[model samples]
Target: MKEKNLLKDSSAYYENNDYYEIFSKAEDGESKVVNYLSKIAKDKIVLDAGCGTGKFLQILEDVSSKYIGIDLSFNQLVKAKIKSRKENSIFVNTNLKDTMLCSDSIDLIVSPWVLGTITDLGDRELCLQDLKRVLKPGGKIILIENEEDSEFETLRGHDKDTRTKDYNNWILNNGFKVMERFNTYFKFDSKDEARKCFLEIYGVEVASRVKSELIEHKIVLFEFVK
Candidate 1:
């Protein structure tokens, strides 16, 4: 499928909390991205933009003084609330382009593979502007996104969205510097498990490519300071 149509198709999967949980569990199987974010979030007021099902909530909650997770999907937030075990955690259902957060309130903002889902440049910029608005002076923003030429791109079957060279340039133009590029993989228990999960998220063509229990993935981290 074309990358432009990717976002539209994602809603069906996202709305189903149970199935979405399977994909989320299979992602970043090593917790490398989560560990990196946890280190910088210590003692700060952290905001998770588009914190689907609270994947990073538990760790972020443990380290940060306060944790806020915001997403447009109410069903995702409901699942997130169940995952959150701390009193400091707050889940809000709102759009990323405009949130009900106060200006200069957040000490750190972590957005995991969220902004890139937005196909429009204008919409992505608005989302960034709102993040900047809530960030305190000298605050930090960490964005984890897919890197091109990896197994993830191959599985997706298209390169028109944020994984393209154009989007890489767009990120740099938006004042985000590349912090690190690392290798991670989806480590499933078995080939059948990997096939079933991939089939659900990416379809039959993508699923057929899963020949091993470990599918290599590449991800890049971009950092911006307010």
Candidate 2:
């Protein structure tokens, strides 16, 4: 499948009410990500890459000076618009590999739970480069990826251990400093519950395998300073 098409399909799969409700509840890592960003992003121009349905963007509305959400899915953006009524917030339908925003224009870049599913390493690198280009000196990039032992292994069909170190190395090589690297896990009531949510959002077989690997579902949040 084409890269863009894969993204679109993924978005469509998560576009259902079940997934949206799961996200809205902040039952996953969304709340933790939002809380961390809100603490450090006060009065800054924030860019939310792959800002699906503006869930994290909504959390930054009051905390950030300005917020721009960019995602590849128009349907997700539509849902975001319905959820957030803030006129100051802008949601743009654009690929992260190529953003319309200019260079050195943003203060903070936040990407939550996005890097893992982007199987195209080149596209992921391009997106990071675009983020770096648009960020001002001394800016920050808050990225969240799935923990190596998390359910995300099945969702993305890739292991985090394979490319996570390289991703961090790339950030350091590109002039960003890693400030904090920690593993955070979220627990569901049962494997079945987790599997159901995963299946509704991703697919069936993947969800089944992911559930089998669940000791406790979790993700890793990486905070970088540029």
Candidate 3:
């Protein structure tokens, strides 16, 4: 599918799909990153860039001093708002590439599995610039990205896979150091949800394989400091 179609369909896809829900549950960095920050960000503000549906924001409200989540998809934000208690957390509908945030305002920014969706190099560069711009001195960035192709997306020929290219080089080129890395699997609730969403996105052959093989996905996690 084209970028235009992607832009148009993303809201509906996020609103009606299990893609974010099941995977967010499966993501290790979602909990691990917050736990790591609990001691550091107890009195500091944190930003969740490209925070689709804000599932993690619910956790951050109890941990971080303040939390802000931003995403481009309105439907996704709506879902986030519903999940969010809106106590100390604010959910905004916005793009990560150009977040309208004050300079040097955030103590930590956790952006997981976001770069692959933003396939364009220029746009990603701009996003990196914004991340640097908004981060306070001594701040850290936690990223959860793919170590390999997303099987369903690969079957569909979509560019939603990560780190076979771009990300590591981008981190190095930007003078940011990756402090740590972790590997984990993106597992689902059951074979049924996996089969349904897989069929919706990848089709019969992939879904059948997933159902039969009990295939859990591979994810790479990173922590960056500037």
Winner by lDDT: 1
Encode model 2's per-residue lDDT on 1-226: one tens digit a residue: 2112234445555444356555334345435666677788899998888877776766687798888888777877777677765678888988888997999899998887676457677887888888888989888787766554543543555463455555555545655544544444444556676666666655665565654323334555566665
Report the C-alpha displacement of residue 137, candidate 3, in angstroms: 1.4
Write out the backbone clash pairs for model 1: none
Candidate 3, 60-153: lDDT as tens digits = 6667888898888787777777877658688878877789899888998888667555667788789878987899888877776654455533
Every model's TM-score: 0.92, 0.75, 0.77
Error (Å) of candidate 3 at residue 192 is 2.4
Candidate 1 TM-score over all chains jointly: 0.92
**Which segments of candidate 1 are over 4 A away from where they belong?**
1-4, 9-13, 159-163
Q: After superposition, how far is residue 165 of candidate 3 from its true place, in Å?
A: 3.9
Per-residue alpha-carbon lDDT of candidate 1 for residues 80-115, written as tens digits (9 for 90 to 100): 899888876788898888997999999999998788
RMSD of each: 2.2, 4.4, 4.1
The better-scoring model by TM-score among 2 and 3 is 3
lDDT of 1 at 183: 89
Report how far off residue 18 is in candidate 3 (Å).
4.7
